[model samples]
Target: MIRLVCSIVAIVLCVWKVFNWAWWKPRRLERYFRKQGIRGPPYRLIHGNVAENGAASLEAKAKPMNGFTHSIVPRVLPFLHQTVQKYGNLSIFWVGGNPRVDIMNPDLVRDVLLNKFGYFTKMKPNPVVKLFVTGLVSYNGGKWSKHRKIINPAFHHEKLKLMMPAFYTSCGELISRWNKLALEGSFELDIAPELQSLTEDVISRTLFGRNYQVGRQIFELQTEQQDLLFQSSQFAYIPGQETTATLLLWTIVLLSMHQEWQEHAREEVLRAFEKNQPDFDGLSHLKLMSMILYEVLRLYPPFPLLTRFTSKKAKLGEITFPQGVQVGLPILLIHHDRDLWGEDVGEFNPTRFSGGISKATKNKVSYFPFGWGPQICIGLQFALIEVKIALTMILQRFYFKLSPTYVHAPHAVLTLQPQHGAPIVFCKR
Candidate 1:
């Protein structure tokens, strides 16, 4: 029996290697690009460019680096820079044996996102992705359309009014905790964890309409699943990975790093909530909360990478890609691009969203925090309102700051999140 098991294991390993070497080598795609006069680094065996790209990513996270050395190009995939730098702005690269063409020009991006969308489709939803945000963020075509229709009413201005009280309840909890801490003389505490807990609680009560304890438990479990998924970094894994925990971890990391923005956002939230008690009917109409939602989506989209697949041949400028390619649209890179948003793009400026999304994108097809086209995020409205309501209430009652132990390193297990758990201290203002 043992011998049979060994034989099966050996056979599986052999078959896996054979498939990777024969069919999945990056060279298979590289040669095609070379034939078409496009240039990229010669593909190495089965690992392809992953090693170099991983190394670059590790280096970038270790210290501050400029875009030229550690950026969307090289850190995302090895030869990413080489491909674009050598072949000009239009180039192709591979990730784990799949071909992906990067179209940096805004015009081509617009065409793919809007004009020629029929040819390209949202990336096949990773099975893991389906678990957490099972609502609309991962759906496509008919199902996505149906869910969107069902969910539309939830995000409407009037519906948000129905959610404000839930937000206030969650926020009040955070405030009470902070006030107790402040009474003990705590100040300059990390706010990320507190905010995350507050948001989770708010989402629980508002969406599930369940008792706060039940909702909080559900959120806590989901958060644990998120964290498990992140630590495993298994692109394909069981659906049970702790998603909620991981999301909370990343949220804390991101919010803590930008301390100044934390203060600014805190001030805004306080102003909004102090004027009202977060009453369900009245506070939903608050414009400041809406602006906060837009800003948070911009600075830290939940899914940093927007992936899609091609159903047929697609053309972006002079380059044409065959079907079955996985296209990754990195929101982090696009959102921070200097050309897209001017030199101040890296800075967190909520004012940019003052004129609303249309004016913010300058009528471009960019800045899709939820996504784009017919398959935009379904839970987007739900998520945004939850964040706004919770933040507004917390700010009215407490102050938060990054803990001294905080570190800045954002990566992807499934969504864009911090490599380390966000550790924050909280105090009442």
Candidate 2:
């Protein structure tokens, strides 16, 4: 009789816990948001909007955009695009029963990212996803502070200047390989993998002071891990996941499409370091190159979405978000917004950045290619320096044009990448 009574109590306890977790909590959060006048797709129990989001993404990916265009909203984030159009700027959505508010307003995005009151914190990535990539980007509180401090010195301008030799050496090898491919006038080659190798070599040698062999092995492992993580969770965005490679490929493709700009940049590069290899000092003075890179980043930011969770009750603008609600700052959508960037938002015009980031965008917070506020990328200078050196070297050796077989399909695996590899015909200058 005692055993029977104990079993009944145990079953009751399990039922109560499940009811609270699966139904009660979600409905309560929905009510809270609804009271604030926020609207979204009605929440379904358990799965939330996962099935909807996944299905929309698959359909979008199946239909590739026809040509060179920055209208990636439909292709990259179809569900969010549709949701925003239906529900408005500050709409709530679900990620497996968790209420996530999509904060598209730049002012609100600034407030969440700045997090001056320390109420917002990074959404903890899944443990399996964390294994694939985690560093300063994943940490929070004291650990994040400590990691940033330790990593800061390595990216200092003076410290990066010392790494110029490594950059030159790696870029030189890449140029040599391209020269061999271009021996018979011009030859078509996929530059995506080559740029990946170049960046990997640069990171390995400069950051760890290791040789390319060691760096190559490290990058190979990282790529495999990233592939596994992408396969498991389609929504996850791992920082530093092939970011440099994707950026380089896009820059090359953009330049190919705009030969006039490419020529102008090459002229600037030549004038900057006439008959000499680019050094840190000389690379910094390539204003045209800098402009081109900024424009490319504006159109194709690596991490399309940046997510933060309310660690405690926090007020962003007019809304007071309850603890545990996720706030998503859709950086890509913001970058490509016509209202923010004018009608030419979709065009590749490097002149937009000729006056630098501050003068280019309507708002400073709106143009966060690397990111904004305190948690901005520590490796910004490192990545920029590497790219400048590589571009300078390539422009000196060859003039490249997009291969006819090249398809302009940009999609996000982790970072924005060409769905079909960037194939360009390289002719020795």
Which candidate ranks first by lDDT, i.e. highest?
2
- Model 2 Cα lDDT, one tens digit per residue, 109-168: 888888899989998879886666576667789977866776677678888888888888
The parts of candidate 2 lying over 4 Å away from their true place are: 216-241
TM-scores for all predictions: 0.73, 0.92
Q: Kindly give the stretch of ten consecutive residues in candidate 1 with the minimal lDDT sum.
A: 232-241
Candidate 2 C-alpha error for residue 220, in Å: 11
lDDT of each structure? 0.58, 0.81
Q: Let me know the TM-score candidate 2 reaches against the reference structure.
A: 0.92
Model 1 stretches with alpha carbons more than 4 Å out: 1-28, 34-39, 64-88, 115-117, 126-135, 187-193, 211-275, 279-296
Which numbered prediction scores highest in TM-score against the true structure?
Answer: 2
Question: Compared to the true structure, candidate 1 yields what TM-score?
Answer: 0.73
